[model samples]
Target chain A: MNPTAIRLSPLDNVAVCCRPIEAGERILVEERELVIDVAVPIGHKVAFVDLKKGDKVRKYGMPIGSVTVDAPAGSWVHLHNMKSDYLPAHMRDAAGDQA
Target chain B: MMSGWLRSDGRKGIRNAIVVVYLVECAHHVARRIVDAAADPRVQLIGFPGCYPNDYALGMMKALTTHPNVGGVVLLSLGCESFNREALAANAQQNDRPVETVVIQEAGGTRKAIEAGIAAVARVRNLVDEQAVRVPLNISELVIGTICGGSDGTSGITGNPAVGRAFDTLIDAGAICIFEETGEMIGCEGHMAERAATPQIAEALVASVHKAERYYRAMGYGSFSPGNAEGGLTSQEEKSAGAYAKSGSRPIDGVILPAERAPGPGLYLLDVVPPGDPKFGFPNIVDNAEIGELIACGAHINLFVTGRGSVVGSAISPVVKICANPETFRRMEGDMDIDAGRILEGRATLDEVGKEIVALIEAVAQGQATRSEELGHQEFVLTYKSSAPSGPSCMPNAA
Candidate 1:
């Protein structure tokens, strides 16, 4: 079976979705099964473990950012839930409007 | 074995290009008209738009004019600009490259300047072609640079790591490899420091990343763009982790500032952010500015990794585009050279793609035109910036 998500590092709390995964679909990351809580697009991250607010999200065995809200295992992890520790990430609308 | 154009400076270039340079923005049109009139793929145009003199700009121009890939230079001056055309011309001439200067005001303005510039380019091109030397080139003799633009999550797992693997193979073969954008390498400092060749070099690496952080923090931007977020990257460090994968897992020999050539064949980090307080805007306004800095550092070719997709190619050195997103590759197949997204699709392994990238590099060095090159994408950019010379610890191994 083709993998829907890949865990880049053993220490990572997130796995990157290799293909578009719909909500409620059950996916296996290594030996553990995860029920997709939300639709995750290709190249986006999915939480492999339960994350609490202010907990650092690890990918590539490094802390990418911290969770802003509580996200259970298999939920989509992105800008809405996490933010850069150094600088805020800009979206298309914020381009050129940075102070 | 591949053959290269041998330069008087003992460097071998995969290409022999005649460059037309405009000293100021006013002379840009005339210089462009000259390049357009030449109608030769080997002829390229590069310039600085500032009317005021900048030491960094002058140094960059000097390095580019005498670059191994460049065979001759035709400088366009608006006559009264503070660019110091005489010094630039003399520098190129000293390197045994044919050099010519067309002063717009002295030549009586637009139409006349274009006419004079066209003549100068033709003369320079002819001299360069006649004096060109063909020599045997080994993979060891080549200098390669890597940069990722329009990057996303797939970049780290696919294209970037594939390039990293290619870099490892190249470095082992004695080729010089450079990975840049210290701004994009924010969170990877601790990991990078551990891979430094010496304790001093590791400290320099950490200091360089800290400087980039301070500089970006002061500027209120972290080189994180909107498209990056749209492509599934959540933060700057996330993007940085992906970007850092292009360096490959090798002991970094040293750090070199922009326009400084690597001391020897090993992995080196190109610190592009300007030193001191952020005075002149962004360190690199666009991707091409970084490409220009890479070329100035003696890179014969650059491997550009992208997930959201970038179609830019440089003026002097050829840029090979590696697409990390299979979806982007399907949509912009014509713009891409390597489909590294195959790793994501599970259609190919990273090692397979890594070998393919090395093979493609050899083919490109042997005169194969990259997709961007065939499309005539000779984008060039240079802006005002200040950088202090790197300290001794930055290159402890350098003689």
Candidate 2:
């Protein structure tokens, strides 16, 4: 089977999509079957385990940010659910709106 | 064996370039006109736009004018700006480089200054041709720098790690490898500290990253940008982990600030963020600004890894572009030097690409032009900033 995603570390709670993953597609991660709930673009992250708000989102064996909202396994994890612990991520529209 | 121009300071350079430098923004047009009129690919334009005198800018100018790659310099001044042209010219002359100065006020006007600058460039070029001595260069004598820009998720797994492997190969060959942008290294401090060769250097490494965090906080922005977010990086630390992979697995020899050369041949971290309170607006406005700092530190060539595909190249030193995303590589193949994305596509391994990068570096060192140079990309930028001198503990291995 072709690899669909890459998990950087064994301790990571999320895996990076190697190619665009379609919604409602069933994929096996570490032999566990997961039904992706939403389309995740390539390079985006997908939760490997269920997460609660305030939980640390782990990647590369470290906490990248805190989950802002509860997300289930196989769900897309991004700015909407996770935010940086250091500084807020800026988007092009948000920057232009401030300007 | 590769041959290079040997400078009086016992440094070897792969390229013998004559630079036209404008001391202030007012003299920029005339300096650019001079370079354009000369029509020589070896002649390039660089300048400081600040009308106010800045110690950092002055020191960078002095370092760049006497850099190993530079054989001659032409200083352009507007006569009213605060930049000290005389001191810069004297520094270049002291290094045995052909130097000339043209003050716009003294030379009458813009047209006249351009005329004088063109003639000065010609004279400097002639002097450089006569003075430059060809000498055999060894791979161990080279200084290489690495930086990541326009990064995304694929960078860490592909191009960044490949560059890291290449850095390891270069360091083993006794070449000096420098990795920079402490602001982008936020989440990897612990890993870096553990890799430090000395206890003092470990402390210095952690301190530099913390300083960059505080500096970015005060400026209301981390190095994290809109493009980074759009490219699928959710946070600064996430991006940093990918950026950190470019340093390879070597024990870090030291930590040095911008314009400070590494004391010996090993991996060194460059702290691009200035010290003290956030007086300057940003640590680095663009990728080119960081490239300037690397050049000032005597980097002969820089490896630039990009997942979102940045095409920028520096003025003084050559930038080897590494594309991390296979899709991006297919789109912008002409601008990239290596397709590290093949690792992700299962067409090649990281070790294979790493060896390819090392081979490319050897070819470039032997006087081959990079894609950027062939396309006439000589982008340069410098801005105001302040930094106190580093302590001896920063380089414990240095005598």
lDDT of each: 0.93, 0.91
Local accuracy of candidate 2 as per-residue lDDT tens digits, B59-128 = 9999999989899999999999999888899999999999999999999999999999999999999999
Model 1: per-residue lDDT, tens digit, B40-104? 98999999999989999999999999998899999999988999899999999999999999999
How many clashing pairs per prediction, in order?
A: 0, 0
Task: List where candidate 1 sits over 4 angstroms from the true fold.
Answer: A96-99
lDDT of 1 at B387: 66
Going through the candidates in order, the fraction of native interface contacts each one reproduces equals 0.71, 0.63
Q: lDDT tens digits, residues A43-92, model 2?
A: 78889999899999999898899999999999899999999999778888
Chain A TM-score relative to the true structure, per candidate: 0.91, 0.95
lDDT of 2 at B344: 78
What does DockQ come to for candidate 1?
A: 0.78
